[model samples]
Target: MSFFTSNRFQDRQAAAAEARKAMAEKFLSRPKYDPNDPAVKEREAKRRAVLEARAAREVERERRRAEAAAAEAARLAAEEAARIEAVRQEALARDAAENARRAEEERLEYERKLDRDARYAARKERKKKAKSPFERYR
Candidate 1:
């Protein structure tokens, strides 16, 4: 003998169908109806509204964060440009200083050469004017 005709199974199945129909009708209604003095349900609705608003606020916060990141990136780029310019200026100054040092060294070398040439010329003239030893003795 099967338990298919049990009274308990029939009652449970009927109750389940009724519950399903009620749920379906509630979902299909356009303007939802809340019974008068619906404090508990009102609180639940308010809670859901607050949760949705919080989600919107989070989206706005993310947008602002992205904008701030972009601004920061721009500022960093400008700073890097300034840093590169400063380095270029420093390199130019170093090159100028090196050139000046080289010029000064060349000037000093030329002056030393001129002094040596003058001394050599004066010694040659003295040798040419001096009398011979034999002439002096005679």
Candidate 2:
């Protein structure tokens, strides 16, 4: 037969109940005011000291980490600023070059127009000086 349905199961239950009762009685018999004992006090003080030391170490570690992160951030920011300034300078130089090229082209066109006007005026003057035969008789 399965142990769960056997007579031995009753004996096991009884033994388990007795064990639980014994454990409860032992727990109740422990001294309640042991905190003032020398050994307990020394152990508590040592634990607190260890906890304080760990806290101090953690704080120092965090401070160093924060400083390192800030330094890295500042370095990155400086690099970005330098890159932006370089790009701005390049754009300014390009714009100045474009303006200079446009000014040169305008100057060349003006010079050509002046030469054409002078040629046209000379041609008109020559035609006016040469008159027809009827005009000479009059």
Candidate 3:
């Protein structure tokens, strides 16, 4: 290493070769994987167990989600049914109110008709009494 290098390309190529050799030596010094090793077999078993546990947890989570969805759907259905029932009840109440109002109007109209007829009959009776006895015979 120097503060500066006269040949930059040579310095770069040497550094690259040294790095490659170091990497190769590091890989070669490490213990190689042997399928028959007890430690390797134990690690594989542990990894398989962990993978199985993760799969079971995922399945459980999915099942819970489905149950929650079903519950939510039932709640929404109940709310909708209640809303429809309320609307039906309100409509029935409105119909009943309308019927009562119509009946009241009819009753008032009949009363007015009766009053008019009574007034006309009284005026006819007075006129008949005012007439002479001979006029009544004629």
Q: Top model by TM-score, which number?
A: 3
Q: Which ten residues in a row have the lowest lDDT in candidate 3?
A: 1-10
Residue lDDT tens for model 2, 4-104 = 66568788999899999999999999877688899889989999999999999999999999999999999999999999999999999999999999999
Per-candidate count of clashing residue pairs (backbone under 3 Å)? 0, 0, 0
Ranking by lDDT: 3, 2, 1
Candidate 3 or 1, higher TM-score: 3
Number of the top lDDT candidate:
3
**Model 1, residue pairs in steric clash:** none
Residue-wise lDDT of candidate 3 within 57-105, one digit each (tens)?
9999999999999999999999999999999999999999999999999
Residue 115 Cα positional deviation in candidate 1, in Å, after optimal superposition: 1.2
Assess candidate 2 and give its TM-score to the true structure.
0.68
Q: Candidate 1, residues 79-125: lDDT per residue as tens digits?
A: 99999999999999999999999999999999999999998999998
Global lDDT of each model?
A: 0.92, 0.95, 0.96
Q: Is candidate 1 or candidate 2 better by TM-score?
A: 2
